[model samples]
Target chain A: DTAVSQTPKYLVTQMGNDKSIKCEQNLGHDTMYWYKQDSKKFLKIMFSYNNKELIINETVPNRFSPKSPDKAHLNLHINSLELGDSAVYFCASSLSGNQETQYFGPGTRLLVL
Target chain B: QQQVKQSPQSLIVQKGGISIINCAYENTAFDYFPWYQQFPGKGPALLIAIRPDVSEKKEGRFTISFNKSAKQFSLHIMDSQPGDSATYFCAANYLGGKLIFGQGTELSVKP
Candidate 1:
C-alpha cells in the first residue's frame, strides 16, 4: 500500500489561476506536512498539521493555504498563482508531532505560465 | 541559524567507489539529523538518520557520521552502485519542529 499519496501528479496553469493538490497518508500518523521543492532542488517546509490542527506555518504567502480535514489528509490550495509558484509540492507524515521519521509522497509537480 | 549548508552540489563516482556528502548547520538547537535520497520524478525518502548523541550510525552500506561540536554531519555511501545514484538531502530539526533542508547534492555513480 502507498503510505503517502498525492493527487494531480502534474499541473500546468496560467498565472492567476487557482489550483489545489490533495494528499493522504495511510500510515496511521498523527502529523502531516506540506513542502515545496524549487528548481534548484532546495526543499523547504511550508506547513504542518497535527491531528487536524495547524502546528507550523512558515513564511509562505497567503496565496498558499493548507487545510487538514482530519489526521489522515492534508490539502494545499493556491490562489492567484504566479510564475514563481512553479515547483514540486510534496506531502509527508510522521507517527506523531514529535516523531523523527517522516514518509513522503510521490509529489505533485506544478507549473504556472 | 535555520540553514543547513551542503557541499559539492553535484558529484560523480565510479562503481564500488565511496560517495560522501557533507552538511553543516549553525543552529545548536538541532538534535535530529537525517539524510534523504530522491530519484528523478520522486519525493525524497529517508535514507538514514542520527541524533546529536551519536557520533555515527550505519545501515547496510549507508552511514551517517555526525559531529556535534563542529555542527557537521556527513553521509557516506560505501561501494556505491549505479542504483544508488540520486539526489541526497541533509536535514536537521529540533524537538520535531520544521526540518531545515540543505540545498541538495546530486550523486551520479558510473557503471
Candidate 2:
C-alpha cells in the first residue's frame, strides 16, 4: 500500500485560476506537511500540521493555504495562482516528533501559464 | 535563509566507484542531520542520518561522516551501482522542528 498519496498528479491552469491539491497518508502519522520543490530541485517546507494543529508556517505568501481536516489528510489551496506557482508540490508525514523520518508522496506537479 | 548548503550541484561516477556528497549548515542549533535520496518523479526518501553526538555512522556501503565542530557533514556511498544514481539531499533540524533542506545533488552512476 502506498503510505502517502496525492491526487491530481499533474495540473495546468491559467494565470488567474485557482487550484487545490489533495494529500492523504495511511501511515497513521500524527504530523503532516506540505513542501514545494522548485525547478532547481530545492525543497522547502511551506506548512506543517501536527495532529491538525498548525505548527510551522514559513515565508510563503497568503495565496498558499493549507488545511488539514484530520491527521491523515492535508490539502493545499492556491488562490489566484501566478506563473511563479509552477513547481512540484509534495506531501509528507511522520510520527509526531522532531527527529522522525518523513515519508513523502509521489508529488503533484503544478504549472501556471 | 538557506540554512543548509550542498556542494557539487551534480556528480558523475563509474560503477563500483565511490560517491560522496557534502553539506554544511550555518545554524549551530541543528542537532539532527539526515540524507535523503530521490529518483526521478519520486519524492525524497531517507537514506541515512546522523546526530551531532556521533562522528560517523555506517550502514552497509553507505556512511555518514559528521563534523560537529565545523558544522558540516557528508554522505559516502561505496561500490556505487547504476541503480544508486539519484538526487541526494542533505537536511538538518533543531529540536525536532521543520527540516531545512539543502540544494540537492544529482548523482549519475555510469556503467
Q: Categorize the docking of model 2.
A: medium
Best by TM-score: 1
Using lDDT, give the best candidate's number.
1
Per residue, candidate 1 scores C-alpha lDDT tens digits across B4-103 of 9999899999999999999999999887998999999999999999989999999999999999999899999999999999999999985585889999
Those runs of model 1 whose alpha carbons end farther than 4 Å from true positions after fitting are: none
lDDT of 2: 0.92
Give each prediction's DockQ, rounded to 2 decimals.
0.78, 0.76
Worst 10 residues of 2 chain B by lDDT: B92-101
lDDT of each: 0.94, 0.92
For residues A1-113, what per-residue lDDT tens digits would candidate 2 score against the true structure?
99999999999999989899999999989899999999999999999999999989999999999999999999999999999999999999999854357889999999999
